[model samples]
Target chain A: MSEAIAPALLAPGRTAGMNWRRLVPLLLVAPLVLFMLALYALPVLAMLSRSLLEPAPTLAHYAELAGDEVFHRIFTNTLWTTLVVTAGTLVLGYPVAMGLARARTLLPLLLIIVLLPFWTSVLVRSYAWMVLLGRHGLVNEALLAMGMLDRPLRILNTPLAVHIAMVHILLPYMILPIANALRQIDPSLARAAAGLGAGPWAVFRQVTLPLSMPGVMAGILLVFVLSLGFYITPALVGGPRDMTLSMLIAQRVEQLDWAYAATLSAVLLATALVIIAIFQRAFGVGTAFRMSAR
Target chain B: MTLAGRGASVALNSLEKRYEGFGAVRGVSIDIRSGEFLTLLGPSGSGKTTTLMMIAGFETPSAGDIAIDGRSVVALPAHRRNIGMVFQNYALFPHLTVAENIGFPLKQRGVAKAERARLVEEALELVRLPGYGTRQPRQLSGGQQQRVALARAIVFKPRLLLMDEPLGALDKQLRESLQLEMRRLHADLGITFIYVTHDQEEALTMSDRIAVMHEGRVAQIGPPEELYDRPENRFVAAFIGESNFLPATVRGREEGHVVAECAGSLVRATCTTNPAPGESVTLAARPERLRFVDGGWPAPPPANRLAVTVTEAVFVGERCRYVLRTGDGTSLVLKEPSSAATRRRVAGETAEVAWSVADTILV
Candidate 1:
């Protein structure tokens, strides 16, 4: 029995030929890579081709983007509005993130609140904002009752309503990453800082803020990138003069101008890639992805 | 280069620390002299670390006060207290290099850049890492990182330096080397160092005095030799060093010694604390104090002797430790020089163990 078992348990180096057996299962899923190439990559390539080649291969779409006063206004307006919304989301989200990170009893409730809006459709949330921010909505009614305003105020159909709705919707995305980052930081680090002659504000400024940078950068990138692609909220709550690039793309698509719509989509995609590159350069891409994943 | 200022004195007058409803540190009072290297030595959960934290102003005392330089600092924040602290993990900022970490206190004090750099270099050299200022903590070895932490603690020349298990992370060899360096630094600078460590050898190696703590109170506070030679209680005797405690009953008393009957053997020991006649007591003896002899070996000149059978013999490079059982089946350990002559004893052989009355401590 010993002799038989010895042969059965021969050294792994003597049985190197069996190593290929481990790869059999992985080989079975190799076809999924081909499927992605066919379905996802082919569509993206077709979109790129259409953006450049459609309506008689020319750079006119790119050239027209620079001189078109309306397109320039929409682009700049979208950039400024997205920046404002991203900043607003960060400022409002940090305290909530700190609360979630520090308060063990409130974490579950805060998580539910953060995810509650995600449960509904974006269109539904935007419409709900329209109802709340309209001239005769709950806010104006409360303000009139408190004698803060003499009449019902026009808060909806303006950039202010769009900013509020965007910030509210994107707050979860900003907060979760910051909270995850804060959680990874060792509480002992702050204590050590305080023990090593740092006041509360200095500890926050030097240790807490620097250590939580990856989270802040990640939240800003996510909120800013998401805000750039926002469509439904701005359309429902913003005035026609406050239309963003996304709304312009939708208008062109609705007018059956697919070539111009594809050009606008390309511009949006390029802008997002450029912003992401800048963010990745500022803070490592790996850290950003880690924060988002958490 | 030379000691210029007298080190700060630290006094904890009945300091207490509580967490929620539980007291982590009970009433504890200690007076640490200026320019002394004092260590708080204890096992985990003994509240030594909590006491240190309270003195450093990281944790507020629930009941009493900590005074530095004879002034109450209980209400002072950590930064304003001007106490330098080295954490167990070193707690070096990963975002900053060694220079920046060492210069942190100087920056907080608003010291000029040139003066900060000069002091940072001097501190680095004091820890013997003169050229490692540019490296991040992660880039250095554990001992080097620990030195950087020490440098950071002393860069601003704080009068009091608090170290919490600073050498606990290093290996035995590195720890021993750093312990010697710390001793030299303490002697050279004449700075008040309140070090906390559970390692008794480290406390003995570097401290001017050791405060052995157990269960939220100081078991004993004395110089290293005093703690080792004359431990005040059973806990301090066992905690500070290897000690064999034999239950004994006091038979008579001399001028300053107690004659006791231990395990069917008559012995006399110097009393650490006075005990009355016929009172039960414990006779503690250091292992190295116990002398060994072969069964047929002649009696020594003037030492208390007891016959015992060798149960086990262990060769520990520098010493040969023998576990022996006495006539009453009580086990005691004795260490002899690890020469070839001492290795001749075998288990199950009878031997004589002897020590002087002065070396045995009666508790």
Candidate 2:
């Protein structure tokens, strides 16, 4: 009995060694996992805790959020402005994406041009927009020179300026993914549709558009999410009345109200996650990631 | 099947297609009668597919006229040409079901809802895929997808149907089955079919008449048996079926036949095309037309005979093929059915191979 049991015990030890070999990779990855848990997840959890339990576990923040008119107006304004900026980016980016995808010789140059602004620091780009959109800027001077305006126009520190800068900065993010998706679609499919008796417009509407939806969805999600957390451009160009959630959180932090700022940051993170979850449920997350990565 | 051949003819008079400086198809002309199954058989780059595409109005002809029922349709678009086409890849829309793909043309023509459903069901049943109407193209097998393409092409019942190697994607057994089904469909529907293929066996098996193309020109056009029996030239002779060619000089002409001398041997062959006496020509004969004759066997009177050594022999299930070499080192392949046992000869043995003058075609 002892001799038989000895081999069985040795077999378990051999199996344990095999399992240890298999898990070596996980052991190697454990450091990065712990770093992310400490640097990213811990701060997020701490913010969430502050949002719920700050000021001796009172519900004052929730009560204030419901009753405050300024917060309500800012929330509505932020949501609508983000939506408008996202829609504007899509409208302006789609044609450029089409051109980039179809143009044979100039596609790389065009892609670089689209991505030129993204390579620069965001604050620097915001400053460049400020110089261009100010009352005494190149645009106002040109309009005045062309007799289209009687004087320098009041363009800076306005919602319009902020929107222009945001769209300019984010358009490439939308266009690149959309162009990648478009390029993957076979041109023969469109010709086949035409041969089957569909006109050009009908072919595009029925085939090209639906087939490129994965790209469009990706562009939309990207532009919307990026617009939600925009800070530098809005702060530099937008008026005080055009303050967004990021600016509000920064202002709270500057006044040394860490608990309030943490609450606001938690709200922003939760809102972004909820929107992403909704999109993922509608269009599969795997497909969305595939499109954007392509 | 009321086939109005005379009134509904498809004619391409000197049609030419040029791309940039290169001529893909130059000066091709043919007349296909309505309801005739005409196949354009050629090797790759012979411009067979270009000719079909020109007929279907996909590629605009750089020169000449294409007419349907006596009306020139040179400038007509593909949709307005009133023709149906089946592509090589099947080209089924992946998003649409089989029923929707079949019903597309009817829907474009604005057929009513009830009639469209009935017609879709009928087309599905015609392709023997009645219950697969709701399945997408990606869900079906390759052969089933090809049948869906066929149903889509014929669902509208167009006057002319063009197929560009439609069964080229299927395996051998499936391709043969589809070829027979297509022939039966053509006979029942009485629609003109213009098929393009590089497969000689397929053309011989299914075509009412075959147009053998070479270098953008119709080398020869005739019924299957006619083209096989009496080819007009060397190209046509070698293209249609397996034939052995021996370079010979015409010695004399009798009636329409020619007496020729090939490789220090005298032979008699019938001239399908006019070749002057004393002119060098190729004597072509089908492999199956020759037979191994025993030493004491009676000769085929008034036929050409030659004594040769069998260099190689192989049994191919139903038949035995022998490679026989003449005295001048010209090898001839002879095929005989396995049932003939008296004339069986082993390799390296000399035997008399005899074939009738009528079986010989002087090209």
| Highest-scoring model, DockQ | 1
TM-score for the B chain of model 2: 0.94
Docking class of 2: acceptable
Which pairs in model 2 have colliding backbones? Answer: none
Task: Supply the TM-score for candidate 1.
Answer: 0.92
In the range A69-182, model 2's lDDT, one tens digit per residue, is: 877777777777789899999999988988988989997799889889889999999999999999988899899999999989888998999899999999988898888888
| Candidate 1: regions farther than 4 A off | A1-36, A290-294, B295-302
lDDT (Cα, 0-100) at A195 in candidate 2: 62
Query: On residues A128-205, what C-alpha lDDT tens digit does candidate 1 reach at each position?
Result: 999899999989999999999999999999999999999989998899889888888878778767877788999989
The CA root-mean-square deviation of candidate 1, after full C-alpha superposition on the true structure, stands at 3.8
TM-score of chain B of each: 0.95, 0.94
Model 2, TM vs. native: 0.87
Docking class of 1: medium
Which segments of candidate 2 are over 4 A away from where they belong? Answer: A1-38, A100-124, A289-294, B1-8, B295-302, B340-346
